[model samples]
Each structure stands twice: as structure tokens, then as C-alpha cells.
Target: MKYRFPEGFWWGSASSAAQSEGAAQQGGKAKTIWDHWFEIEPNRFHNQIGPAQTSTFYENYRQDIQLMKNIGHNSFRTSISWARLMPDGINVNQEAVTFYNNVIDALIENGITPFIGLFHFDMPLYWQQKGGWESRETVEAYAKYAEICFNLFGDRVACWMTFNEPVVVVEGGYLYDFHYPNKFGFRMAAQVAFHMMLAHSLAVRCYRSLKLPGRIGIVLNLTPSYPRSQHPADLKASFIADLFFNRAFLDPAVKGAYPAELVSLLKEHDQLPVYQAEDLALIADGKVDLLGINYYQPRRVKARMTAISPDAPFMPDWFFENYEMPGRKMNPYRGWEIYEKGIYDILINLRDHYGNIDCYISENGMGVENEERFIADDGQVKDDYRIDFIREHLKWMHKAIQEGAHCRGYHLWTFIDNWSWMNAYNNRYGFISLDLETQVRTVKKSGEWFAEVSRNNGF
Candidate 1:
């Protein structure tokens, strides 16, 4: 059966600079936190392999894009390494420009549209020394960097994302230990998030200033918060969680202001992020042309009556606790629940509340353990589960479109199996498999299925 997408639907996959591009030290790429951290704590990374030894996309992007075309990608999303382009967030490198230009031209020549992101959690070590995103100077530096990229690659790259999952950069790296600069401080995380939003707004302003032809957007990982029960406390808890995690950024980036509840909560706790009056105006006026939604799972919340911190400093722990509901479908390999309807809910919310902004599923896929187990004797991977994972999500996404949502496309989390942050290479989330030792790329079963979907515009 052939299920066709709407006219001009985009088909592609997504990858990050740090995850796919090796040769980290060669292209005038100053060390990022990952590069520095790997040198110090090799054991922290999976199999002790650092980001320097990725799929080597930096050298093989030409062949890689051809592989993308072979597997069926009319569009592809990838990020520029901040350090690669600027080295120290201050000095621009000509060699890096030449490299990316070649890559952009190659992808375009093969009829693959490039969706480029300005930053993807890889802060240059120099910037990290300067307090990373927590410093306002870093925010300005990012704006300048974005301007450079806009001028350099904007002609061919139609889609520009200001930042990929800024919240994850703050939460995962600052509050959790899953990423570089692993410091568990909510205060610092809040500061970093505020600066990140500022950086995003500044970048959008730069893109607008350039009068670039393509649309500019920001990619956010939006996890819908669900209450575990009908109890008022639980409902309130969920509301607070949503305000903090979802609406804090969503309202500003989409609706052009921070959520009132979030402001009130922060004020009540004396944790309100410092902001200049002009910052509000800039954010309000510098709204994105589109939105990139990365939906992995929904958050289930229940009220927490007791104050969370005993001796620790301020945090948002007074709000709620995550509750894993019974009978939820689980992805054993990734530890995330499968909830296809969440996609429909996200689309519906965008239509009703967020003005139905032009958007796409920027990243969505199933990550499996030991995916090599599925490699067949025919040199193909039998990844039927991945096909199912994507199909289920697309089924809901298509339904949302029928109901008047403005979803433009769907790009899976990755094209080739590559290294992930912290998880390293443990979880495979690609339509194609990669042999790390030989740097060999083989198309998986899902890759063939995706080809047909792209050829037909849908499943």
C-alpha cells in the first residue's frame, strides 16, 4: 500500500556535527568540551572512543550524501561545529569555510536540501572557559557566528536552525551528568538556558538581517507533560512541570513571551533569570520562521508535597516527580516509552495554541541495542522494528495533517549509525549501519523501506 504525503513534502534524516563528523582536530577545529573531556576521562565515553573517531563525515561527506540519496533523502539536517568554524568562538577559519561550502554544494548538487543548525551542544573549550552559554558575551559571540554561517551557506541552505535542543544543553549537561561540563546545579542551568534563548533570538535577528532566502527556525525537544491522576495536586504538578520544561521556551520562541506561570514560579522562588528589557523585545520580534520539533517521549508527572532539597541550593524539585504509568509500551534498548499519539497531541497543540507555525518532526527514531545482531548474510540489516517505530509515528503525524496541522516534513534522528553523547555508540538509531573498525556503511532493511516512502512521498 502506498500512502502519499502532501505536495512538496520533505524526506530526509538528521545528524549532528559532533556525532557524525570526525577529524575533529584537523580542520582548524579548536577543542570542544567533548574533545577536552575525552582526553581527561576516557572511561566516561562508551568503549572509551571519543568524538574524534566518529563516522568521519568531515572527510567522506561526498560519499555520505550519495548514500543518503541511495537510501532516499531529498533533504538532510546536520549541524555546524561551532569550534570547527571559529576555533575559539572568536576567530573564523577559512579552511573550515571551504570544507562546509564543499559539503553544502555536494548535497545540493545531488538534489538534497540542507537543513543546517548553528550550534548543537558542542561549546568550544574557550567558550567553556568563558562560562559557556552562561555568559552574555558568549551569546553575542554566537550571534556573530550565526551571521557568518548565514552569509557563508545561506544561499544554498534553505533551513537555518538557531540551536538544536538548547534545553537539553542546559538540562543534560548542567543538571545531569550525561554531557560535558557535567555540573549538577539548577541555578547555573537556569542561567545557561536564559542565555541560550538570548543567543537564539540574536541569531534569528542576524538571519533576518541578512535577508536570507530560506526560513530560520529553532529546534526544541518538546515532551508533553501528563498528569498521573485526576488529583488536583497531580494536575497542578503537571502544570508547573509543563510551564518550566515546555512553555518556558515555547512561549518565547513561538508566542513571543515567557509563560506567566513560569515567571511567577521563578519570582516566588527568587530564581527568575536576569534579563534586560531589550531582551524581551528582541525575543518578541525575532520569532522563528519555522519550528523543529524533536519528540522522543512524554513526561508523566505527579505532585510532590515535600520540599525536595534538604541542604542543596534552589531548584525546581518542589514541583513534581516523574511517574512511569503502568502498561506503557517501552523501548528496552533506549529506556523510553513508545507513545505514538504524542505526535498527534503535539501537532494539535501547535494548531490550537501556537498559531500552527510551519514545523517538522526534526528528530524521531528508535534506538536499539547491539543492532549488528540484525545484520544479515546479504550485507543488509533486518531492522523491521525501526520501520515499525517510524510508521507508527508517521501514522499519527499524517492524521494530524488531515486535521489541519502545519507539519512540513519528518526526518529521522539519524541517517548512519554514529556516536551519541555519553551513550557513545551503545544505541544505534540509524537507517544504515556503520562498522566502526572499517568505516564501512551498509544499508539496513529500514533504509530500503525509507527509500520507497521517500520515492512515493510517504508510506
Candidate 2:
């Protein structure tokens, strides 16, 4: 193995409850925001497909765990559906508890470590009705819910995450129109972002209060921002973009604070979110024990040449302009740039700037549209492109590790081709491909190769 990883490197994949668990309306589970959104505006989803029907992890988890073992996975990550566990976001659901326990027990039985995440953007409709993350009440409820999960499952689950890609919740739901309850405004975005962080701190406090046997953290999708040129203006633009996207959450999670520059900029624009006097101390308590980074692309920025009118809505873009670099590598299947070295850049940045924190690649994989077109004989998907994608990214990541970055593991975006929100399986990203119609799972060529990589501890 030319690119061998350190001993005990974790190789696995991630999926969320909302994306993989098909019993969206069954098992005493109440409606989630995704379920309700699909119900009213089914047309908004691809192929008019919604979360009501999924890869059926709820029913097929046992078989799936066996498959994971066969494919040489030593760890796996998935979220518990808050909506399923607490239909009204207050009381416990015993049936859902039984289901989750079975899933966790089965994973251990098969020699796979379980990484449980509490929230993954699947807000219970009951909570959404009460203003979701925007309301302080939801923040308090979330902490209570975290405490319940800890008392119930924290003994066996040694790894936990408070939320996955929380900034996406703020950007997608409040700043942009891509998500449900979409309203475009910076004030709402800032407020929601603050409340979610507060909720994370409270949950961290709850976990510490119980002294659970696990380490809890948050998963962030960290895209490294690069200036198009070395010019000071372009550099400043890139710095601001980084502040808004990466450091906004990273600082609080790792350092128990926000960047001073970000605070000054927000203050200059009179866009500070309303926070309690004690919120600062609480946020300082939210520092994580581990960090999960999801890296897929890089953001290239340039100085803003045009001025924003005073009446224009304040957005992160107002301070910088996105610059599309010519001749950049791209993944045409999913319309995302393919920059393998960006992984190294991110790891090195963490090593140099963030105290070399313990971290791992939680979600990194290629998604291909119409992947059935690549099927080969012997009933397997001939996904060489996916193989090359993983190998190149791993190569860069290996270099970072060699340079003293504290990266611990790498997990693909998914285990099976689960339903992606809104995109709904349009782009398949899994070592095991799924037959949506018949619910069959077949290991792709990359899966065989990955099993070998796991067995060898690298490629």
C-alpha cells in the first residue's frame, strides 16, 4: 500500500435518518418538515419523489450491517430521527427507542462502531410550528432531547454529534430559498444561526452534566476559501468569505468564541443577532471534543468591484464576488469542482491555525447522475471514476497526515445510495448501489477496492 494510513484509521460512511430511514410516517413517527414539505409541494422535489419512501434502513438495517461488515467497514454514522423519537418534541416514543436500540446493538454485534448524531436538519413538524431553531423554546427543547438521548444510548455510543452542517440550516432555510419555510433576509439568518449555536452549547452542557462516556461534537461542511489573486483586495474578500462560512461555526466549536473580525463586520452593518448577556459564556461552554469536517469543494473569491445599494439585502456575497477559475477540474455528474488538494489544504489549515484538533472526513464522496449507465456484467456497477475520485482525495489527505495533521479517518458520503433531500437520488453516491424499484443492493467495483483498502489500512 503506497498511501498507508496510521494504525486504527477508521474507514466508513455516513447517512442521515431523514435520508435513509424509510419509515417516515410509520413506527409511531409523526411528520417531519421534509414529510410535510413533500406532502404540500410534491412538485418541488425531483421526480416528485419525497422522504415518505427511502432506502428503507428502518427495515433493512440488520442486512445492511452485515453488508457493511462484509465490505470491511469498521465504523458507521447515522442520525436518530428526533421526530420519530419524540413525535411532539416533548415525550419519548418507546417503539422508536426499541428500533434505535436494535440498530445500535446490531452494529456492535457486527464489529462496527456506531457514531450517533442527534440532529440532521430533520425538524419535527411540531417544533417547526413553534418557530423551529428561531425560537429560544426550541433551543431549550433540543437540550432536553439531547439529555434524553444521552441517558438512553450514551453508554454504548462513544461518539456523538450535536448537529450536522448547521450553517446549511441557516443559509438554506433563512438566507436562500432552497429549503422549506424559505425567506430571504440576513436578520433571520443571523438569528437562526445564533440560536442553533446556543442550542448546541446547551446540549454540550447537558452531556457534561451527565458525564456520559462519549465525546460529543458538531459536523461542519468546511469549504476552504481561496482568493483569485494575491492582491490585497482579493485576499480581504476571501478572508471575509471564510469568516462567514467556516469560522462562523468553527471558532465557537473549537475555541469557544467567534472571530473578532466577524463581530466587527456584523456590528458595522448593524446586523448582530439578538443574544442574551449570558449567551457568550454558554457558547464558550460549547467547545467540542471532536470535529467532523465535510469537504467537497473550494470557494474562490475576488474583490467586489460593484457597490451594494443601501436598500439591498445584506448577504455574505455583498462583501466578495465569486470568481470562477478557468480550466478547473469538475465533476460533471454532480456539477461540483473536483479539487483533491483542497482536502490537504483544509487539514493543514486545521493543524496550523486550529491547534491541530482531532478531526475526520465525515462526508466526502462522488455523486453520479444516471449511474445505471455504468453497470457491468456479473451484476455489479463498474464505477472506476468513483474509485479514482476516492484514491486521489485519499492521496492528498495522506500527505496532510504525513505533515502532522490530526486527521483520524475518512467516511464516504453514504453507505448505500440513500435519498438526498430535494435531489432524491438523482445523483447516486454509495459504494453499494441501490435498485430503487426492487430494493436490491450490489457492491460496486469501488466497494471491492475499498474493502481491500480497509483490509490493508490504505491503498
lDDT of 1 at 251: 86
The clash count for each model shown is 1, 0
lDDT of 2 at 331: 92
lDDT per residue (tens digit) for residues 343-447 in model 2: 999999999998999999999999999988889778889999999999999999999999999998999998999999999989999999999989999999998
lDDT against the true structure, per candidate, is 0.89, 0.93
At residue 381, give the lDDT of candidate 1: 83
Name model 1 segments beyond 4 Å from true: 305-310
Superposed Cα deviation of residue 245, candidate 2 (Å): 0.6
- lDDT minimum window of 10 residues, candidate 2: 175-184
lDDT (tens digit, per residue) of candidate 1 on 272-305 = 7678888888878658889999999999989985
Best by lDDT: 2
Candidate 2: Cα lDDT at 122: 94
Residue-level error in angstroms, candidate 2, position 266:
0.6
